[model samples]
Target: MKKQFFYIVLMGLVAPLASCNDFLDMEPMSEITPEDYYQTVDQVEEFTNQLYADILTTHGSYSSTFEIDKDTDNQPSTETPGNKYDNTGQWKVSMDNSSWSWTNIRNVNYGIEVITENYENGTITGDETSLKQYLGELHFLRAYAYFSMLQKWGDLPILTQAFNDDEATLVEASKRSPRNEVARFILKDLDLAAKYMTPDFETSHTRISQDCAYLMKSRVALFEGSWLTNFKDTPFVPNGNGWPGTAKDYNKDYQFPAGGIDQEAQFFFQEAVKSAELVAEKYKNSLTRNTGITPQSVSDVNDYFYMFGDDDMSTYPDVLLWREYNKGLGITNHLEVIVQGGYDVTRSMVDCFLMEDGRPVYNSSIPYDDQTIAKARSNRDPRLVAFMKQPGQINYFINEDYPADHARKDEAFPPLDVGDGTVNRSLTGYRIRKGGSFDKARCDQWNSYTGSIVFRATEALLNYIEAEYMLTRNIQAGHILEYWKLIREAAGFTGAAADPQTTNTYTSIDKEKADWGAYTAGKLLTDVTLYNIRRERRCELMAEGLRWMDLIRWRALDQMCKTPYHVEGFRLWDVMQNEYDLEPADYDGGNDAFVTPPSRGQYIIAYENIQEKSNLYRDGLHWMMAHYLEPLPIKQFLLTSSDHADVELSPLYQNPYWPLVADSPAEQ
Candidate 1:
């Protein structure tokens, strides 16, 4: 079924390129010449679809490892020597690696240029509505590409057009714009895209729609606003101390396009609220619910579970955009298989989930050391049960090839036991079950066709709440309380039903105190409302590739460096190890094997432990403020240096605290 759909879309995409052979095969200089092509709206739409296939596909979304969520505070990876971002001291400047490339920007700008020029000249002889819609998609793609660049490299060279191959023109275009100015430019494109985009939702949820644009606007605005607010005193943000961005001589005293930084933040935050409100109001019913265990619904326990693992998300109205994978089309990923205990879930994440009674897990009567798996998970948020692989839970059924000896039977999984000397086991005993399909046939396969969600209305709701809370700093605001109620109700909070009036009981003040990421360590969050809001986001969006970005925008990593914070796993040595055979002969003696003479009470520790058993970070996790923004490649400076003979300094400035080296060891 998905194959047919892929072929249908592929045919639509291929037809335009096939028809415009002459235009496509034109000289490199005249390849994007508007007069040559851009004749029909169908062709324009087809061209825009290429952008979706190229830039927005799931293939482009994933990093080298499918598990991008690993190595964070919430999720720990199996491999030692934690992710480069976590290793602050070892990080160094590279000569070639950077996000300054313009390949995608050129593609998007070329499409926009062709559409704008052709539409203005009255050359596009097709349905104006279709042309406008495609134009909207191009603008959205351009904004998305620019935002991606802005996130990696603070300031960027804002280019709305394809540049010629002339060296002089290329050199002039390399000037970096202010981060705030770049953000405003992205918002400008989003506004245009939203203006021209079709108002109706796309049933496929794969294409860029008005809602997607609005969602992205909210995301971009909130990211910039939060970055400015959190790191206002640092050089990472615009108008901050040691900021290197300079306006051209003509605009020496260039004012912020929005206003002063504070006012600018408010403007963006308001925009976030406005756009997110539109999505929440429009798709309020699309939110997935955790309808409690019913006789008829017993087969599919949680709607939220299948929302991530299902082959199709067309039924979920909240999903604004998703990438559909088809095995027959040779477009599939192993995410479904990987989520099943492949990437380890950390204890920190497990503790984040609120109790079923809307209280923190720590606030329960059971002591920390005495809490069993069942005790820890008991009366917790339904999402925890739905998303995590609990002890002794039946995950899937295994069918026997020979029926004479055996019949198909359900596989009862054991508790999170990592020191078991198994390769596929979780590094941290806790494992992720969020994206795993319950069906054995699907879960067992390598490349399952389960769709990946790109944008969902749940994110918009969270965005609106956070943006509003940030702007007003009033958690008990009428609208804020209402949205919180909606989210908790949909999530199947136990207290949600009784608390119709939306009282503060559901907001556990005690739970806020127990939150590890809050107030303690380096985090300065003091307000319970603010802490709870962040907690909601952390719980709802766990292992969704959003944690890293959240930490960056919130500037939360500084807290990790303040203390000897350890990335701890389950109580493997203390209790979980007993679940497996302890004999020395049972071990494989591989690098992933349990430490010899396994030390008691020492789970996977971030820093070196006295037992020398499970230490991934021997040197300890140290974070430098300079790591907040990646350094520009030194090769860029060298190239610019060649343009001038007498200058000892390069034309561009390196990111603050990042020493510019002429050359360095190539990235492995």
Candidate 2:
């Protein structure tokens, strides 16, 4: 995997900027210069393959982002931070570095440039169909790089035809494009890509196929449409042009578009559904649930969850795309399950699952917000049990003897002996199982090889259902209920369908199959659909680090920024009184001569270290516009052309919400 990433970067073909002095250039010691590389089909194919490798080179999966997105009200960090408050140890913070982004963009654009040049010159010729297919793949990658930039920085400079010295000269003066325009450009590229891409799943687990393109289109469309419609307070334009430079006060008031939420949202959602359906038509796949598996056929539903346990593609065909991990490549052993001593899913998200009856767990008659956790979770969606672990649930698989003594394996336990007790050690008792391999013994490293799940069949189904729900309120008519049934069956649940409806919308359920209540009643598909997708996304792409982007796009960061899970118990002990019949020390309020109580097992120890809950959820405040878009760096802003300078720059550089650098003096 590392070599694959390195080869892509090293193999990139970028002609150096025009030389100034001939003697200074010398016979440049270069490895297969760009001039000789783009003259053949094989060369182009190799170059594109290397470019795909760049995706693996940049930051390891979404692990960094997940720390900030999932470790708050939505969920808490399962692992206690060695240092609190200065919890920069989380996932996304590491991604804030400017260099990583530039390198990634450079690699992707370089690939695009080579492919485009060959295609234009007619220098590369292959089986016509195969050539077109490969071209589609190249376009898809370039689009993906731009999309990532858009997600992170909102609007970025559009560098479409690749950047050589001349393009660089122009780009150096180019400012940021509006997010709306950038999104439009991405969609255009994808539209062209879809036309040429091979409409099939890749035979190899890690290669991008045609379906991947559609999945990306669906994702980008939904993101833009949702943000434009739902985030009204942060309109794309103030007056006629984009973002007016009037308001200096972050607190004064921020407003986007009014219809960006209600009516306008429906249009984009409809488009999202169309793209999703296209992928499903081509892939012919769906997420398999527990209902189909017999108890005797497999050990449990968990067996299905660990489908990607081995990186050996020879054995596992379920994984669509991945980066291979080899032990010989200096791979070190470290648990890849991010939840163990890192961030975990939020509790609010736990409650976000729909009930067995198709109602939100919150809709239960009981006051879910109160302390009745067991009741709040009772009768909830069965997926919750499959995804999360609560106390008393027997989770075997720790130091059990393998091969000879597989049956005697002991359940792994979380570290609970922190100075502050086990309460803060790991907030969520449950650890994530997604992307974790059970066959670690075969690989030299424990589980260091990380492979990203770029696209899967399940997401296609989700996209289809989300679109269906938006177009028609009636789950039955919209076919939303059917998809829910498919998901439930795949997860091993079987029962009457859940069909719920809203009174205001006059939503109706077929009287014969009122069982489909869950979908009929689900409104704004934003939360329900978001929740459904989030769970599968989390479970499917655990260590690959995809969950963090979803959190940002949905503006769920505030909800996931604080510690969300804490263990609570009654205070039951003081210091010890005596030791081995030694004389007692002088009594003091802060005396060291104290002891814990004998009934320690029964006594409760309150853990204030619960996951910090988010105050930014609901009311759409999570979707606020400040971090919605990233600002160009101060240097770029200054050099931008006058036309772009007229457009508003991000306030972040001027007055950052989060400090860009740590104070050196404070550290001392």
> Could you say which candidate leads in TM-score?
1
Question: lDDT per model, in order?
Answer: 0.64, 0.43
lDDT of 1 by residue, 1-668 (tens): 11110010101111113333533234222354455667888778777877876666353543212366666777766555444544434567876664556656766777787679889989888888778888998999889888878877787777776544344555555666778789989999999999998887356777779999999999998888888887776777666776655423422455676677888888888888998888888877657986532111235566777787677977788878877777788676666555544456666787877766666565543333413455545566777766665555655433223221111123223323344443364445566566655544544345566787888788888899889988998876636777777777777874643232322334554554323446432566766667777878888887777777777788776755555455666655556566666655433333434432244245554333322334435434556567777778766666555344322244456676676674432121
Q: TM-scores across all candidates?
A: 0.84, 0.65
Candidate 2 local lDDT, 1-668, one digit each (tens): 11111111111212242344421122121244456665666665666676675654222433332344343334444433212223232222221236225555555555566656777777766665666766777777778877777776664556653333232344342434545557767877788777876655356655566667777788887776655543444433221123432333441243333333454456567767888777665544335443222111124545344543434443333344555555578433333434223234433345445555544443443233313233434555555544443333333343223332112122233332243442234333333334444332432224445444445566666667655654674556554656555655555555542332321122222211111111211122323443443444443344444444554455443221332322222122222111123222311111232211233332221222221232111111111123434333333322232333422432322211322232211110
Error of 2 at 175 (Å): 2.6
Q: Candidate 1 — which residues are off by over 4 angstroms?
A: 1-36, 57-66, 81-88, 246-254, 292-298, 365-372, 397-423, 443-446, 496-521, 583-603, 606-616, 642-649, 663-668
Worst 10 residues of 1 by lDDT: 1-10
Residue 50 accuracy (lDDT) in model 2: 69
